[model samples]
Structures are given as structure tokens and as C-alpha cells.
Target: MSSAPTPSRSVIHGDALEWLAAHPGTPGASLLTSLPDKAELGLPIERWRPFFQQAASLCLQAVDEEGLCVFFQTDNREQGRWVSKAGLVLAAAAELGVPLLWHKIVLRRPAGSRSMGRPGYSHLLAFSARATVPAEASSPDVLPELGELPWSHGMGLAAAEESLRTIRRASPSTRLLLAPFCGHGTALEVANRHGLDALGIERNRKRAERARGDR
Candidate 1:
């Protein structure tokens, strides 16, 4: 019986935007990340929107042309209005001339359930500058539920798995996963388990250390 190859993980403690700008278009790298919400950044909605757009643009730009950039985001209600992170990401991708490869909805709560602040579903969107997914290679458009979350704002295990599966199919040459704003290393851990090297950039020192998974 053959064994799976061990993967490597490198967690950097610094601003994601700075890192992305400094290392754009990384070869053999794809992205799977969840951008931080306004609350986490301690910024007003007005300020956070631009920040989110810029972060999304950088993420899309950081990957190789043949690589995919996936985002896991949930919609939230702010000041009696719905704020859609998916919409924001779509706009960013549009500006960059990237095409949407797929958009899957992952249930945060059971179907037909109601929520107060965030919706009952989260968006799993993939974009690529040149990669294309054929109709025969399509996966589920909607996920039944988010498997397990490592933190309150981390990517779910099932979602991460699905994203990586899509990447494996769409971009077979992808050897690394880049995660910016990695909360608790949920995606990083999942990436390693899937035999892909993972690199994460986080602004919070404590969270960055935790993302390293050394202890």
C-alpha cells in the first residue's frame, strides 16, 4: 500500500496586501481564502468596502494565469441592509478581467432556516484568468452543509475540500495553496492533508503563530 505524500505549511505574520503586492503572479500557486469582515478590521463599512475590494483584487492577481482563486464568504446584515461579499468579489474579478469558474452555495444552517445577522448560506466562488471548467467536470453547485469550522470565521472543512478538488481538476499543475487572511489555519491544514503545500499570510501575530500549527 502506498502512502500519501506529506505537505509543507509556511505561515507568515504580516499584512496580506503587502505580501500579495510583493509576490504577484506566483507560479504553480492557487488561492483559497476568506477575507476578513468589517468587524474584524475595526473599520466602518465605508472604509472596509474599499479594503475588501483591494484584497479581493490582489488575491486574484497573485495566482498564476492558469491557477484558480477561490473565496469563501458569507453575507451579513449591516445597518438594516444586506452586505454581499460575493458581489464585492465578483466586481473585483470583473475589473481584473477574470472569469467566474463556479459559484457554490454552502449552507450555514439547515435549509429554510432563518438567521438574524448573517444569512443561512455562504458563497464559494472560483475565478480564473485563463483556466476553464468544462460542463463534464462540474461539481455540486450547492453544498448541503458546512462540515466543520475551526473558528467562528474560518473556512469549513467540506468547503475547503471541494475547493481543492476543483483546483485539482481545473489546474493539475497547481502545487501550492495561498491563503491570505487565514483565520485559524483551517484551509491550510486541509491543504496539507490533500498533499499540497500551503502558505498563509495573516496580520494578527497570535493567529499567524496558530496558523503555523507548530504547537
Candidate 2:
């Protein structure tokens, strides 16, 4: 028996927005990313809202027509009011005429749990301009728990796996997984482990190096 070939992986330290702008409508590629929140960006909610929408729009634009752009977002409270990152993504997708393929909820904490800061559940949403998900391809809308986290801000291992599986089933032709604002490259590692080529861009040099598994 022959061994399987290893998948290719690349981690670039740069601005994700600039990269997305420079390479719009990337072919044979799908996106899996989490946009920075107000806390990470050091911006007030007023400023961060528009920035988040713009980033989401850019990510949507960068995806191939038949490819999916998946976002894993956690809702947070600001000034005693809840902010919905998934809603922001939906707004951006609507602006670009991209239809939502699926929206799944991943639990950060067990049901009936209470949290004071971030919500107990995170949103996993997928969008595509030309691709449609078949009825037979449907998966659970709610995942009971997040498997594990490489970092506080990293996407959970279980969630990442589910996202990739959805992409593989919905868009079999997708060969590359593009992750912007990749943090420590949780998604990149997961993608490569599952036999897909991975490319990630992070502005933080240290995080970029870690994403590349540098020693």
C-alpha cells in the first residue's frame, strides 16, 4: 500500500485586508477565519462595527464563486448590550448578494450555563455566492461542545473539523483553505491534517511563526 501525500501549508505574516484586496476571487479556494473583535483591534464598538463588516465583505469577495467562506464568531457584550457578530457577517454577505449556506451553533459552555462576558455559544456560519447546499448534506445545527482550544482565541478543534467537513461535502472541488487573521493557525493545522492545502495570513509575527509550526 502507498502512503498518502502530505498537504501543503503556508503561513504569511501580513495584513489580511491588504492580501484579500490584492487577491480578489481566488480560484479553487475557500476561506475559514474569525474577524477580530473590538478588544483585539483596540477600537471602540462604533469603529469596530464598520471595520468588521468591511473585513467580512473582503473575505466574501476573496472566495471563489463555487467555494465557501466560513466564519467562526463568538458574540460579546458591550455597554450591557449584546453584539451579534454573525448578524454583521450576514449584513456583509447580503451586500455582496452572497447567500448563507448554513449557520451552526457551537457551544463554548454546556447548555444552561451562565457567562458574564462572551456568550456560551459561538456561531459557525458559511456563505457562498454561487454554491447551494443540498438537503441531503445537512448536518446538526447545534454542536454540544467545543472539543479543545490551542489558545484562548483559537477556533476549537471540533468546530474546525466540522467546518472543513461541511466544505468538503458542499464543495468537493475546493482544494485550498485560506485563513485570514489566522492567529496561531488552528484552522490551518486542521485543514492540512484533513488532506487540504492551507494558506494563512496573520499580522502578528509571532503568531504567524507559530502558525507555521516554526521551532
Candidate 3:
């Protein structure tokens, strides 16, 4: 951890897999990321399984025994059937010895505003190298604060912030929040706003510049 290169706000512009391979951290550091969906990326559904499988392995390797990962994903309609992308991640994590600690629903859809053929909610799944404590004593499994949000690459800022709060409660000593697929630094902004150190990695130069508040 001490040997890992640090960037401003700990955010670096590079591949997350490559970064994680070199800078694994201890239990006090956690990852809160809203990954790009296969639909959003224009990738086939079949490709996501292996991709997330590899990602889960990398994430589990990067964190310590108690370090947790909060993955934000939404269910989508694929060729007339509903598919849970989070489910794929769950299986991937399980294969790598990480267990699902909690599954939170971000109720982003308001009454009558639901999109046709899509679920009305998104999921925030928390995982840890070790078994995660039950979330019943802390935050509820359904988050109602996500009624409205600023959207970027299909993720909302307020929603991401609220989700991070849940993870913080679970990992109170966590000092840094890392977003591997940071599109416009939404998670990074939210983490910094809460007085936590945040790191973002984006391969897109334009979005990365926007995240840094540069013109």
C-alpha cells in the first residue's frame, strides 16, 4: 500500500485492473463502484459473466480480509426477459470466496414514471473477503433517497452517495473509496463530500478531464 502511487484525490487515469494488481490495500480501504452495464457498453450479455468473474477476482485480491465492495448495478430487459447483472457478480464473488453481505434496492423509479420493459429499481450489492455482518442493524435494504438524481453514464450522483453511506456504516474505518470505472467522478465527488479520500480511474480522457474540473 505504501509503495502504491498516489494521484490527486487518489484518482488516476489508467486501467483499474492494472492498478489493482499493483496497489492492493488492507481492510480499512474499500471499493464503491458503479460499473458500466453491458447494455450501456453495447456488449453482449454473455461477455459480462467472464468479465465480472475476472473483476471479482481482482477486487477480492485488492482488499483485505474485512474490506468490502459495494457494486451498483441495475436489472435490464434482455430480448424480452429480465436479467439481473448483479446476480452475475454475486456468482463471481462466491467463486472467489467473497460472500454477499447485503442487497440494497435503490428505488429510482417514481410511480407512473417507470420505463417500459425495465425494472423500477437498481441494486447495491455489498461483498467482503470475509463474511459481512448483517445489514439489519444499520441501514435498511431499500434506499428511498434515490427518487431524483443527476445522471451520468446511467448512474446518478445522489443515488451513489446514499449507497456509499451504507458501505461506510459497514466499514467505518475505511479511509479511501475507489471507483474503478469512474465515468465523470460522481463517486469521487460524493466520497470527498463526506470527508473521505476518493480515487477514480477513467480511460476516457474527456470524461477524466471533466472529473478533474478542467476545461
Q: Summing lDDT over every window of 10 consecutive residues in candidate 2, give the lowest-scoring window.
A: 129-138
**How close is every model to the real structure, measured as TM-score?**
0.96, 0.96, 0.82
Which tens-of-lDDT digit does each residue in 1-215 have in candidate 2?
99988999899899998999999998999999989989998999999999899899999999889999999999999889999999999999998899999999999988999889889999999999888888898889999878889888889999999999988988888999999999999999999987999999999999999999994
What lDDT does the true structure give each of the candidates?
Answer: 0.93, 0.93, 0.71
Clashes of each: 0, 0, 0
Among residues 3 or more apart in sequence or in different chains, the pairs in candidate 2 whose N, CA or C atoms overlap within 3 Å are none
RMSD values, in order shown: 1.6, 1.2, 4.6
Least well predicted 10-residue stretch by lDDT in candidate 1:
109-118
Per-residue alpha-carbon lDDT of candidate 1 for residues 51-148, written as tens digits (9 for 90 to 100): 99999999999998999999999988998899999999999999989999999999998898877878999999999988899787889999998998
Model 1 TM-score relative to the real fold? 0.96
Position 200, candidate 2: lDDT: 99
